[model samples]
Target: MVLLTLMAAVTIGIVRARNLFAVVVLSGIYSFLMASVMIVLDAVDVAMTEASVGAGMSMVLMLGVLYLTKVEEAVPSHTPWLPLFVAVGTAAVLLYGTVGLPPFGAAENIVHAHVAPRYLEQSIAETTVPNVVTSVLASYRGFDTLGETVVIFTAGFAVLLLLRGRRRSRPSDDA
Candidate 1:
């Protein structure tokens, strides 16, 4: 709970920051903290992913972007109240929606009743894999995993294409 509170504070700091570099650093810290939270929740695989992709690769990418751009954010021209009100309104609606959800970690949840048992009992036979984790990811969820990979590749390719074509301003150019 303490760690989660710290993460929220760091997130608020990230949002309030005017220095883009400081924002990037805080974002990395948030990812690392999130990874820690995942670990505490006993989702080590997800924690490892958060650490590597969220903290590691994202920081590298953000640093590369910062190298090519200004470190400070430009001031906004309009009042922020409208956006803030909208955000609070949306959050209230979402919270109200979750009020109908079953309590967390309840063993009688639908997933525990149906999907998990099937995976444990039949995953190896259907997928012909010795490891449950391997069979689940590479066979059961294979299409979804492949889709994620392709999407990531496409996004990276698009970013490279866009960055490659960026026109740097000349020192002699005058208004």
Candidate 2:
């Protein structure tokens, strides 16, 4: 509950912040808080990934972009009512969608009843991996993991290309 409150506060801070740097820092804090929540939920692997990718690499990337841009966001000439309405609508829809989800950690949940047991019982024999989680991610869901890796790699490569283009477009001091 406390972690969720902190996460909500951080989210509010991020939304209310006009300073780009402060927003980035707050986003990192939010990511760290989310990682802590994941840890509390017994999702250490997810927590580690969230910390490293969300808090670590994302911060570094945003800071790099900030170095090349203004620290403060420009005030818009007009109120963003359409975007505000869209955001509220999306949130409402998402909340409505979650209403049908099984209670958290419920033993009779679909994953618990069908997926987890299969992984726990057959993981070692099928994958020769002692860790059930490892077997599930590496062997059972290898294609999914690979797809995620490809997406991340493509995004990083695109960012690098954009930064390179910006550098090339700038006038060199030595020239």
Candidate 3:
């Protein structure tokens, strides 16, 4: 409940903040809170990724964008009703789905009985890594991590391209 409240407040702050820096900071706060929620939900890997990418990398990129652009701008008018309706509808659907979820760590869950157990048991032998999650991320599913790295690289490259200044070449005197 507290995390939900924090997320709501951060969303409002991000929308209402006039200063770009304040908005960026609020966004970082939102990401951090979301990471905490993921941790509480027993998704440590997701939490780590969110903390690093959403909070750290995103804040750095936002700051770079702000540095490349003007600090102040005229406020644009936007109607919030459509977005509010969509958000509420999505939340309602998610809540409805949550009602059908098996209790966390229930033995009858296929997740625990089938997939997770194999990963837990075989990962050490397969990868010679003590941490099963790390082994899975780095060895068992390396291609996915490579793809993610490429995506982040692409994002950084795009940001650099956006911020790069174009120089005009002078016509040669001989020409």
Candidate 4:
């Protein structure tokens, strides 16, 4: 409960901050808080990934980008009513979608009955990996991991391209 409140406060701070540097820092804090929540929920693997990727590497990348960009955010010329409405609507739809799902931590859930047992039993024979978690991530779900990597790579590449374009369009310092 304490972590959740801190996370909410950090999210509000991120949303309210006009300073880009502060936003970046707050985002990292939010990520760390989320990782802590994951740990409390007993998802240690997810927590580690969130801490390293979300709080660690992502913070470094955003900070480096900040050096090339404005420190403060510019005020928007128009209201964000459409975006706000869209976000609320999306949240409603997602919540509605989840209404039919089993309660959290229910051992009789579909994944527990079908998928998890298979992974525990067959992972070694199928993937030849000693560690079940490693086998599931590296072999059983290899394509999903690759897809996530590609998405991250694509986003980073897009940011680099945008930065390059902005640099090229600016007047040279030598002039």
- All candidates: TM-score: 0.85, 0.86, 0.73, 0.76
Number of clashing pairs per prediction, in order: 0, 0, 0, 0
- Candidate 4 lands at a TM-score of 0.76
> What digit string (tens of lDDT, one per residue) describes model 4 on residues 137-165?
88989999899899999988887776676
lDDT of 1 by residue, 48-131 (tens): 999999999989888877876689899999999999999999999999999999888888887678666888899767987766
Clashing pairs in 4: none
**CA lDDT, every model vs. true structure:** 0.86, 0.88, 0.83, 0.87
Better of 3 and 4 by TM-score: 4
TM-score of 2: 0.86
Poorest stretch of ten by lDDT in candidate 4: 166-175
Which ten residues in a row are the worst by lDDT in model 3?
166-175
Among all windows of 10 consecutive residues in model 1, the one with the lowest summed lDDT is 166-175
Which model, 1 or 4, shows the larger TM-score? 1
The TM-score that candidate 3 achieves is 0.73
Segments of candidate 2 deviating more than 4 angstroms = 166-175
As for lDDT, the candidate ahead, 3 or 4, is 4
